[model samples]
Target chain A: MIETRGLTKTYRGGRPAVDGLDLAVPRGSVFGFLGPNGSGKTTTIRMLMGLIEPTAGTARVLGQPMPGAVRQVLPRVGALIEGPALYGFLSGRDNLRRFDAADPAADPRTRSERVGRALDRVGLAAAAGKKARAYSLGMKQRLGLAAALLQPRELLVLDEPTNGLDPQGMREIRALVRELAADGTTVFLSSHLLDEIEQVCTHAAVMARGRLVTQGPVAGLTAAVLGPGGHGRLAVTTPDPADAVRVLKEHGLTGLRADGDRVTGELPEAPPDGPAPPDPAELNAALVRAGVRVRAFGTQRPSLEDAFVRLTGEGFDVAG
Target chain B: MLRADLLRSEIATTFRRWRTLVLLAVLAGVPVLVGVAVRIQTGRHAGGGGGPAFLAGIAGNGLFLVFTALAVTLPVFLPMAVGVVAGDALAGEAHTGTLRYLLVAPAGRTRLLCAKLVTVVAFCLAGTLVVALSALATGALLFPLGKVTLLSGTSISFGEGLLRALAIAGVVALSLLGVAALGLFVSTLTDSGVAAMATTVGLVLTAQILDGIPQLQAIQPYLFPHYWLSFADLLRDPVYLDGILRNLGLQALYAAVFGSAAWARFTTRDITA
Candidate 1:
């Protein structure tokens, strides 16, 4: 489990890279840290890993306050931040050997065996003898993952693990993450890809401009965005668009945009002034009273993209 | 676990690098070149009046070539090689982005820095030993071996002279601890290995230059390399220890000051790379 209390990091004379934000990751969940680029996902991961001390606030990773208890805790956590940080001159096997030796608790006697097992786990056994500089980007990324798997870690923190990989490579990494989760390891995965996070994460948190916009289980996020008070858009597919628009306008629906036979507007049920606005049934009855032939009239189910857009007021860049 | 187990890995990785092998080869070549050059010159002029001050007495005893080779390479070659290795210790990792992995290994920055220091000192000792051994071999092959006359006009047995040569090599290596520590401290300040290496070597040259200037005599003793050649005192009868002791004490001072400085910087550093 990972817990953070107002964990913040501010560069000298610059804005906070990671603002005062709290994050909680339950054990054995594939926790997705979602954000757009420059949303401080990497900074938070780095602070949790104790690679950079928080400028303000604090964090506890796996039941221990980071940096202070790093030695006692880091061995149980595997991480690959940014990308594969490797020695270009050394062979992949030797690089793993060097990393394995870094853990004081590691058995030096079985170091080579552990290295071999890790390399095999990441499917880099065939390229283990090649210098890391000669490896393809995907190979290097796998090698980084291999270094993380050198021991039995209770948690795995991967920062954009599939950043430069081909589609196949990304799928492979995603599968590996799911496999690790199946083994009961807590995986705190940070990514800008909504679909990747949605596909792999059971629970998710969205960060925007160094702040936590929202956090919850994947289904809960959808429900939160779709509930009566949530920002749900209404779309009406009807042949009698003029009558439907007149009926919707009478109900005081604002920001109506229509093209051809389709009329779209925000759900207008929640009102400030008086009695609750008519329910879908009442609205349909009212439209029927107006002699409007209704084909389909319902609130649009919000996608993660829609919820993210509603939360951050900017569209998510799914292109990357 | 208290001791840095990473030292083994560091040594293995460092010595296996092509850069380290080239450094050792160049160091070993210095003695052979000095030995062969001295042999040819001394062969022609049996009663030579000129050459290096150390080679002046080599014809009387070939073992003196060890001392002569140490002197010839100590100024630039040996220290330059030490500078490259020491400077590359941390900066190279940062350049290649491996420092992040090492620190996150929870190796603890102080412990990792200590491991690097141990590796560099290990190299210094190995480098000094290689130069001494190569010069001794080359000298033994080129000249006659016999009882060696001391600088203080006292003669010692050949075995005792060889012992002295070993002692001298150790002293020379110890003298370089200051350079190694300084280079490591500089390494912590930068991420570029080449820049750190060039700066470390530049520091050595700067100190030597400062030591040589008459105007800078007031600050010469404060410089790390100022008392480097003081190992020559070990060849004197009565075993003069004043200059040798001063040189070691100075090296210890530099190592302590710069070693802790490097530790302080590296431990608190935000490893953004």
Candidate 2:
């Protein structure tokens, strides 16, 4: 639903904020734009929304060239850029009404009904009569979400949609996103929270320092970091730590370490210097044969956070 | 294509603000203050002269109060009120970050600009009518009402004088289009509403001061405020159209120039705020 070709934005006398980004957001997919702060996610989103023109490239939203086609394309796209910007003096309901009125395509006769429904969807219906200035940060975030949902959109571009929400609010927003995706709306979400992307996104693009590091399905990203068979490290909790370590080493597990009664080591898949990795069942049997009193045996799978950190060469705020 | 709903929304939002109400209240209060002051001065000294153009005639015919109040406020108070409203039109939205929402609502840039200009022009008419109505009511209460003597010394019926008064109010309102357009142009240049308002009002004051200088007479006629007081000629026997037409024409020139300038700057400029 959204595509960009060599999209770059360079401020005067400064490095490009968003550099040569070629992004594709498929229709009806929950695409997560994963990046750290100042990684050009918002800049790219702004360019896509046509709020700011890209200095040197082109962005097509909904298959129409942006800025030039803004009048034609924007009515079908809903956006919440940066945060919820509202008129503090106006009540939340009035705010929605005003925005609804701004859209020439919005049906005037059904405006009030739609605004009320949107407010209810964001859980702001009770507070609709109150001035937006009196709303809390989380409420404001929800109101911004309400604005994006005011009109049924073909594509929803949200920048940091869950930024100021509590844990419950965040969960609610995530659920709302899932629901919207289920209805076939293309969602382009950007955030620094790795957990959010992992929990909600079907596809994601990782960006670092204005450059795209990688992009694909979330499962594939984690699997890529895990290598073949998707195995990471094997941990064995046993009474005989030395015996367990000796057996694990004999089984060709690399980087064996023992602490107290636990032993852990890398379960390399198809190691260049060794035979293929043994099945976990056979490894458990080998430990049992060594007379190690095994309490628990498991292979740890790599997480999306680990994959993202490795791919971006930087740490992300893993929790929202 | 101007959307009626959007225009209604703009008008509603602009007028609903306490700031706008206060500006109108101040405008309404001006006529009362002038009426009461003239009533007191006429009672104290029997003859009123050397105050303002129409102040001396208020005691004889209450209708003159409308003319007097408009004359008193037109040069400063009226345009200043319009300056506040027009200058804040776009910049205020930018300051509050509502401009982005409005634009992305697909309120076409040109259409939104048109809506803002229409709202500001509406304010101009509303402000002028407020002063005129307040003066008329206060005039009726404080003094007698009857025939009005024109500036050419010909007496006209009270109804004709009232029609002339409405026309004069209209002329006064049209006289402000230049300031309204100039303020809108200034609004597009900044994201700070206060800065835009101050700059617009400051420009008006500077132009008025320049129009007053004898040394600047060569360019005085080109200033937007040069023909502002030409509405007084409506009181002439034949109702002189020369200065009134010139005033309207000059305002149209400023409106066209600044209106296009605003459109150019607003449509092309980035909306980062």
Question: Each candidate's DockQ score against the native complex?
Answer: 0.62, 0.71
What does candidate 1's lDDT look like per residue over A182-275, in tens digits?
Answer: 9999999988888888889999999988888889897688568555535566778888888888888888776677778889776665557877
Q: Write the per-residue lDDT of candidate 2 for residues A123-221, one digit (tens) a residue.
A: 999999999999998999899888888889999999999999999999999999999999999999998888898999999998888878788788887
The number of the candidate with the highest TM-score is 2
lDDT of 1: 0.88
Clashes of each: 0, 0
Docking class of 1: medium
Q: What's each prediction's TM-score?
A: 0.89, 0.94
Collision pairs in model 1? none
Candidate 2 all-Cα RMSD: 2.7
